[model samples]
Target: MLPNPTLDQLQVFLAVAESGSFSAASRALNRAQSVISYTIANLEAQLEVPLFERSGSRQPKLTEAGTAMLEDARRIVSDLEVMRARVKGLKEGLEAEVAVAISVMVPTDVMVDVLSEFRERFPSVSMRLNVGELGEMIDLVASGISTIGIGGAIVKQDDSLSIERIGHSFMMPVAAPHHPLARLNRPLTLADVREEVQLVVTDSSGHTKGRDFNVLSYKTWRVSDIATKHHLIRGGLGWGGLPASLIYEDLQTGRLVALELEAYEQGEYPIYAIRKISNPPGPAAAWMLEAFRASLSRCPNLEAFKAQLPFNRSKDAIAAE
Candidate 1:
């Protein structure tokens, strides 16, 4: 192991290197000018090196070796300060920090509620939240780029990850209340749905891999964002499937209406709390996951949503694979 220099010695070295004058360093350190000179001299003596030279000036200048050592000394000083700060934070129960990635389809209100509850329970933990789609969130969590992922569950299985199904939501066909189909007295058949232009929301890459609801195989028009999709649907431009939780008020107020599709597939993608299998979450991350689970429990829409996503195999069994 390498010998470690005292904090006092490193401080004096940094002061002299930064101020470039022993007298200036003495003033900065609130010590006598002789003390700064003696500290540097003793440090050089112990290390057996010439750290500075007079170079025809009253104040010394760093030698080549001293310039090189200064960089390393600066880094070491920074690391020590960071370590001290982290220790102080931990002792005060303020060390918690987490970065979270969430899906945009989840309501802003839901996020606010989760954050409110989480802050109340763990006021020390500072969270950084990023909202995007499922694929972006998956990439972030899988790469250890994010501490926890919140959003729609992965439809496919990956051996490198473990997904915990913390909650579920239902997808239902919706259209603007005044749309022609909403006035139809009969149940909507496949042929009827195929005739109407459908509005779909996808990512920037224009990929609609797993999100296509099987109910409508109509002429699909794709938009790149959820907000745009909502606007398009509200404007009566097309029909689309939206989360029931998000559109409940719209449905009740007659701004949007749920379309009844005949012979439609009722499917539910698991809403997961996904984390990489190789990187188990730390305390802050784990607490956030638990908080999400708690949110699901108290949410009134969850019970009906779980019924929609009936699982043949338990989440524990799926995670085991």
Candidate 2:
């Protein structure tokens, strides 16, 4: 294996790559032109490859191998930056910035509001957003790639992390305007749905949570994208359990209606704001968590049930249900 190149060599490489002239790179980096040339020379020696092709008059240009090495050098610099950020974060008392991941099931608008509030309060803080499956969010938190995560209730038996029930999000079985359920006056019985087609969002391995819709004969139309599922339901394709936040406007506009069920509560999952217990989050992350709670409280449509609950509910209460 090749020895790891020093950061100084990578910086010189980047400066020359960007400026296309050793003299120009020296000027930009405030170093001597000979030093810049020697740094690149040393890097080439270490890597045992010619990084640049010299010409009589034209500026030095990258060879094919140099182009690939340039990409690797950029990644090395990025990794250094992350290390610097982590150390700087520890020294500066949470001003150095951190990434937080949240699932897409949460409303984008609400996240925007929470992030905007966080930015205004801590102007120097930085953030990166990762939107993925619930499992991915949990992994980000557990692995320390992210300081915090917002996701749905993880039903598996792992106990590596802690969860806070910041809010309650229920899934409403919704269908388009002309769907048969929209015309029903009374609550639809579980038996009424047995024969109906269903749309579901499954995991990477094609698994979905919640109880089986036995009345519908356990049929399903699998779709990956949440937006696609919403649109498919709107197009009168099939019924599915969608987050209440995503369907707020549609429910009000009469474009979609929640199906009544004998056991309406089966599809509900507690919206969790999680962090690894071993890694107490930095102040900026904590602020975002608070802002998330505030946003949930301010949503009038959901406030009735969510406003009264503390971010961390008793485990007994969670398990009692």
The TM-scores, one per candidate, come to: 0.61, 0.59
C-alpha lDDT score of every prediction, in listed order = 0.72, 0.72
Q: What digit string (tens of lDDT, one per residue) describes model 1 on residues 1-321?
A: 344567788889999988989999999999999998888888887677788986798878899889988988988888787677656657865436778888765555677887887776655566787776647667778777777888754656778878778765556777876676665635788877788888877654223365665536558888876778788998989888777677766766667767777555546545678888887777667777887777765554634643544233323432343
By summed lDDT, the worst window of 10 consecutive residues in model 2 runs over 309-318
Deviation from truth (RMSD, Å), model 2: 12.0
- Candidate 1 lands at a TM-score of 0.61
Best by TM-score: 1
Candidate 2 lDDT over 1-321, as tens digits, reads 766678999889988988998999999999998999999999999888888998675798998888998988898888787777667766878757668888776776788888878877765566777776646677778777888888753756447687887765556677775666655535777666666778866554222354343225366787776778899998888877777777877876666766656544544456678888887877888888888877765654444533432333223432343
**Could you tell me how far off, in angstroms, the CA of residue 243 lies in candidate 2 after the best superposition?**
0.8
The worst-scoring run of ten residues by lDDT in candidate 1 lies at 310-319
On the 0 to 100 scale, the lDDT of residue 160 in model 2 is: 68
